[model samples]
Structures are given as structure tokens and as C-alpha cells.
Target: QQQVKQSPQSLIVQKGGISIINCAYENTAFDYFPWYQQFPGKGPALLIAIRPDVSEKKEGRFTISFNKSAKQFSLHIMDSQPGDSATYFCAAPYNQGGKLIFGQGTELSVKP
Candidate 1:
């Protein structure tokens, strides 16, 4: 029931291209920013994340860019492939309420 606005709602990319998804939040209570990847008929899995202490972090072909001042973050997938196609959701965990607020989710399609 928290408000975390996610943009584009969906995305399409070709193999070996880059895929990017963005999300913004109004509540500054969020300390941890994480992106979850979900496939059809499966649960969401942790993909990449960043903390307020850093501006960006990269893992493999995945990267997370965080802006503390803007209360925003993004997930970038480099060299995207058909296997990378899935739904991505950005989350912000509120410590006080112990609830993880998730964005609307972005559906990514990587075509070969």
C-alpha cells in the first residue's frame, strides 16, 4: 500500500542490447533499494541492489544506480539476451513498518 511509481510499465529489447528500468519513491524512509526479477509461473528473485551510501553498484551484467537526493533508482542490464526477459520490480523496504514496497513492475522482453 505504499506509493512507489515505476515507469514504462514494460520494455522491449533485442539480444545483446541494453535493458533499463526505473522507479521513483516519495518516502525517504527507504534505506535499501533492490530489484527483483520474476519469470512466468515463478517467484521473484533478487537481482541487483544498492544502498544509500553509494551512487551505483554493478554485478555481472546487472547494475543499480541510486540517487539519494532524488529518492530514485534504476536497474540496467547490459548485453541482454532472450533468457533475461522477465518482469522486474523495484522495492524499497520501510524499517518502521516492516513492509517492502514494490513498484508496479516492468515487463522486459529480449528478442533474438
Candidate 2:
């Protein structure tokens, strides 16, 4: 089974600083990469996404940088805040059924 390897199981950042998470995959068949954020009691929500055709994508304070050659991608959180504290996951869609294969997940904490 294809998998996404995520780094830094947890991260701590200042309220106004930046938080970064990285992931790498082995399957070249995967074309879509999406980042999800989950709060304590809520289901995960899509934060941002990028395709192999695009090298980078940004929305509000979230950004996704993709490197097709290396089969890797990363998420950057700008101006990290307490509200941004949550578990983030990176995932790729399965080629056949379109199911998502997710990484282990990274817990982020923004300290004031």
C-alpha cells in the first residue's frame, strides 16, 4: 500500500511565528495532495491542496509546496496562532477507488 511519510510528530511555535510540516510519498501515480486540519472534537477539514502541475499554492495563511521530482510536499502555516493548534495530516487519493491514504499526522501547538 502507498503511504505518505510525515515528519515531526509534534511542533510548537510562537503565536506570531511559522509552523512547517513535511511529507514524502512513494507512489508516482498519486496526483493530488491535500492537507487537513482537525480540532479536538471535530472531524478533519481540508486546509489546502496542490496538484503535481503546480509547484506551489497558497490560501490565506496556509501554503502547500510540491516537488514532483522528489515526490514530496510540505505545508507552511504563516502567523501561527492558538486557534491554529490542531492535528494536521497530509494525504493522497488512491488511484482506483479515490480513497485517501493519510500520513501519521502532526500535532501543532501555537503558544502565546
Candidate 3:
């Protein structure tokens, strides 16, 4: 149950629109849920994250919603801009704390 399934493999949003991406997991051993944003040639950067204790977390235009009972979480991007176009990944570090189980990446494209 280490897999974190994500949806809307690809999305196209108009500039200034809201972009939402979702993910679900089955593992309960995970402690930290982090959403990462990756550009074409750079490593994924931490966009936002939440703990099981927190129901939701927000950073600027990026927000992450967590459902501990459902083993799910989602990322919301408000005022999506063309610069926000990138691949996003939802991940949780295993109990051992070295490896990360990731959801299928969501590719978002913000059209101008």
C-alpha cells in the first residue's frame, strides 16, 4: 500500500485560473505528506506539505489538503500562471525515513 495514486495526468488551465491536483494513498505508516514541483531540468522543489495532525496547510497561492482518515491529500494552486506550468508530485517518506513513495506526476500547463 505504498502507492499514492494521482489523477488528471495532464491539465490545461487558463491564466489566473485555479488548478487542482489530487492524490490518494493506502499506507498509514507515512508521516509527512509533501507536494513537490519540478521544472524541466531541475530537481523537484518542495511546494507545500502537511502532517497528519494538520487538516490543511497553505503557502502563498499553494495549498495542501490532507485527509488522514481517507489516506488522501490534494494540492490547490490559486491564480495559476504560465510560470506555474510544471510537473507536480505528491510524496510521503516511509517510516524508515530514507525512501519516498510518490504519486504519479501531474503535468500542469497554464495557457496564457
State each model's CA lDDT, in order. 0.89, 0.92, 0.89
Model 1 lDDT on a 0 to 1 scale: 0.89
TM-score of 1: 0.93
What is the per-residue lDDT of model 2 for residues 10-35, given as tens digits with 9 covering 90 to 100?
99999999999999988845589999
Worst 10 residues of 2 by lDDT: 92-101
Which residue pairs does candidate 1 place in steric collision?
none
Flag clash pairs in model 3.
Answer: none
Rate residue 84 of model 2 by lDDT: 97
Q: What is the lDDT of residue 9 in candidate 1?
A: 98
The weakest ten consecutive residues by lDDT in model 3 span 92-101
At residue 4, candidate 1 shows an lDDT of 86
As a whole number from 0 to 100, the lDDT of residue 49 in candidate 2 is 93
**Which candidate number would show the highest lDDT if scored against the true structure?**
2
Q: Give a tens-digit lDDT track for model 3, residues 38-96.
A: 99999999888897677999999999998877877899999999999999999877667
Stretches of candidate 2 above 4 Å error? none
